[model samples]
Target: MTAVPEERVDRFATARQIADAVLLEGYVLYPYRASAAKNRLRWQFGVLVPPGYGRDAAEHSHQRTECLMEPRRGDRLAVELRFLHARRRTVQRAVGSRAFETVEELALADRVLVPWDEGVEERIELTFPVDELAAGEVVRAVRLAAGEEQETVQEDGRPVGRLLRRHEQVDAVLRLSVQEVPGPYGTLRLTAVVENTSDWRPPAGAGRDAALARSLVSAHLLLGLERGRFLSATDPPEWAREAAAECRNEHTWPVLAGGDGRADVLLSSPIILEDHPQVAPESPGELYDATEIDEILALRTAALTDREKREARGTDPRAGAVIDLADSMPPEVLERLHGAVRALRDVTGAPADPADGQPWWDPGGDPGVDPDRDRVQVGEHSVGAGSRVLLKPGRRRTDAQDLFLHGRTALVEAVLHDVDGSVHLAVTIEGDPGADLWRAQGRFRYFQPDEVEPLEEP
Candidate 1:
């Protein structure tokens, strides 16, 4: 029987860095604005909160996260826990009355009142820390909490109204454990779990509680390894070296382990991260040529609408420099800008064939008399609709779905192309049937062209 390999980490950042990236995932985007539709869902990943709760009530919500890690024996592992705390602020706005007299009613006039502008204030009040966990020990739970901030309204230096505290106390809990696995280099498995243990709930019948509840229970975990070396991809054992080489990249590689026989496996990343930089260009001309192409591509892909282009020039400070350069250009040169934009848009927007590196319209005339003979050639056989194909293993996959579908034969129902012009085979596997995955109104199983091979007919 073929041995199943363990999952491994390829690329990783420090726990703190990972936490920061996770926290920022749904927080905001470029041109950050509260009104941006993209910002509607603030936190989307790893959320654990009650069904109906608000940010204010989240302080009382409990959330937990579990992470698995592998450490070498005798090595001390340090785990750092971190999270963000939001603080509320109070501000006072001046209220005043205005009076105006109409021409017809100039003899008498009453007072007209204008609404005061709303004021906002924000700050980070306090920082809470969770207890650190050591190697081989289990962290049952660690709690975190923040106090509420008081708010008040004042008129002419005298308190006119005392508003209740707007900020609610926040709390959370974290748990950790380590499991040992026997291997060539005495391996230890680590698991870290974080939980929101607050018992707070939002007020019943609150209209926006549902949306708030979704964001309240979410948390991000940033994991980092501080000790030990990860297995090497290029230098893996003889039995597993081939698999490792196929999967090797700058960030990760498949590890090899020797068992009853030999098997290609996966190992987690080491604590220390390494960098691989591109080699320097051999000639100045070559460098300049590449740079020129990159600049052309960048301008073409910017693809901003006229209104957006104008808005960027008006609002973005960086655009000022470019605008100044364009303004100083000769009239004849400036007149060509519009044409250049259109030309670039046309060229970049056209889809090109991946196989021949030519546009779809330029499919160099038919080479054979049979027009239907262009079906994909897989292995030693050609496959088309109604043809049978077997799923390939260990190619372009990091999930269990690959293992589940590996070696399974499927019937190709159709050949489809995505909006980007990539091709896919629409297939239904034997013994396993399900609804097709939909994206942009089209159905697909995300099987890449290379993940399948045609099965020859008997």
Candidate 2:
């Protein structure tokens, strides 16, 4: 591995914070305990199961990412792969002096232990020069062997029960290859692949759980550049747009993650995210469920009863830490979790002083603006709050999921105008039962004036 500079190391630390959150995104959900139904289906992302065991659509044997980067001579790239190793835990009861029988739960004088699968963190790092990758493919063998662990429980020096944990061996292969992208500029496209080459096969008609035992849970890649700049797979420059579109990414997507608009690092993850994504600085700590609202989870965890909390503590160490954190959080800290006003910007897009420009903050006070009554010209007609329109999202959909709304009828909630003088229509899907809730939350899908067509009166 190349020796990273002090400044580059700091960037790595920043990236690690977000990567850790991704690794544990669905490890546990609200309530932070195993008893929760949602928690039972945890480890939802980046799981690559063994060959014959992964017969279902949810399971897979490999993941790959293709990204573009501009590298000069002597430039180097470092790739770090992170994942979770699942450890199956079980409890046994003492039936005789030297014999024991497997049990579901074990209770001792101090605590009660419940059998649950726990994850241990694993990391693999590799580095290569630009010339080396461009010359030919670089491959590395990734292997973690099968193992078992045990711990004994005793009452007054007499053995009462014991715990057993085990994991299956995993064999994987990591390969990387690069090619110069076609264009007027000197851009290179890098293809990185990770495959579950583990020869382990499950018994006939085995379940998903058996397959997952040999899987790489919550796996992701963090790539760093020494003297080169990587392009964003989500949003590429105009010149590289055609080339970027040609890149083939499978199961995972790469996004710029070096922060502050730096292009020296890329985080290819199974979870879709924008370029330069950051963990909220206001967050209290890692709740292990990034998909859920941190404030809501903390509040719910704080509301758990004493008995419920005890079961949560016994379920897993991470869950216990969550319960402890919620109990120790102060009112002031909770308030911060509510929200933060990062900045105040005027209609012209310049920073505003809350002292005197407070009136501008309220659009209702400004006679020139009225979200409820504002009208914007859409095609040949004008559309307002009470009008209806057909949604036609832009050709370049940043979120592919938005395609589900194409050609759908929507009620216009507002016609908004920004500093650039561009008009947008905020709308909610017609006939949706949750439309009222969405409106109350001020959440609506937005499209440009050209992307909406005024509907005819019925």
Candidate 3:
């Protein structure tokens, strides 16, 4: 094959990060519950089945995951394949009333029950040896399993049926193969194949197939590089890095490469081979659907109650700020604001009405005053100097900073407004390191009016 150009090398690191994000949380989804219908079919990537249908019918099922890897000359690539080997036990019970039925016919005709029996068997976690393969070379590893004997049926501690030994020898086989593809840059392609060489077929179309598929396991490859360096999220190619950075809540971003050129660049994520049309192209690794924002907003509005709103203002800083802003307006103006929120919720299919009979915002007979100059109130407390505030967790935050101060207390030094008429708070923590670090190093954190709560004075 013709070699890919050098400029294309930068994309490899970004692609590896995206693939890793998918691999780490490949089977995990939001509202993680197996009973959820949407979560029933968890495995959506690189699924392979045995030649015959059904779990027990097929002697062996194999799945292969492959990814293109680039390594500099004289560098070794460490490839590791990790996965779970799930062995299901099948129990046979006679359906019809036949005491003297032949063991062969009974075994063939009996209904099979696949259950998770305590102390029955343990799942095997298979991990291949980390193979440091050289560029342009092929490395292959295989594992074979010996099947075990199981009883067909037991009646009152006595064996009523014959002994059935299923797939007596070579029950399963797992293979890992890595081949170095000759290219302009030293490039290697790694492929990991898992074969269910046992004669066990999970029931068809009962979600068991998907469940079994998910049990296959995840894999990661660590490559040592010499001349080439991996790109960081801060570097150029913002398009490649933004998704991984923004969706940190849903996916993990492992340090793919270090600052030094000599360190190993790790692609520690599974390669998803199957296509998922449900996932948006921009955020392929997102656990929740892109439209989940609408659903979440709808749920919030539908469940909005006066008691809940009061409690939110009392406890939640963000909600309190927004509520206080609404509370200062005239009753008719408050009605308009509530109507606007309800209208937005209506567009998103959320219940627009508040739980209380009263409107969302009731100023309680407004006192005539200049509304433009009034200080914003957060739960009966105005945003002013010396006010104790709590930070909101869901506030939009800049990248590269940890959420260390969320829910923590801070004293407001000043309440400032922006050119856009948005409110901001300049605050200082009690034990903050220093003012110099706050200003020069960006250690000082600022909050939007809606991102903080004004606490009642003690």
lDDT of each: 0.38, 0.83, 0.41
Best by lDDT: 2
Error of 3 at 403 (Å): 47
lDDT by residue (74-109, candidate 2, tens digit) is 988888988998889898999989888987666654
Error of 3 at 108 (Å): 41
Candidate 1 lDDT tens digits, 1-458: 11211211222222223233333333332222222355334444444453335545433243332222244334433333444333332332223332222121111111111111111111111111211234344544433344444343344565433322233444444555544434445433334444555566556665432333322322433233334433344454454444334431221112222122122112222112222212122211111112233233234324444443343343222332333343344545434433322233233453455577554442233232221243666657677767778877555553687678888888676665544656667667766546343323345444656888777673
lDDT of 3 by residue, 1-458 (tens): 12433433442444344444444342423332222356444444323343333554322255444434454555433333333333333444444553423322222222212221111112222322224443233434333353556654655665555433332122334444556444454444545444544444445454444335323333333333444443332331344343324322111123344322323443433332221112223221233232244234333433545544443342223334433443343445333333222234222333334554533332222332222334667766676766778876444553434267777788776655543456667777756668546645544457777778777663
Superposed Cα deviation of residue 309, candidate 2 (Å) = 1.6
Q: What's the lDDT of the predicted structure labeled candidate 2?
A: 0.83
Better of 2 and 3 by TM-score: 2
Q: Which one wins by lDDT: 1 or 3?
A: 3
Superposed model 1: Cα runs more than 4 Å off: 1-19, 50-74, 86-92, 96-137, 140-142, 146-166, 207-218, 223-226, 230-458
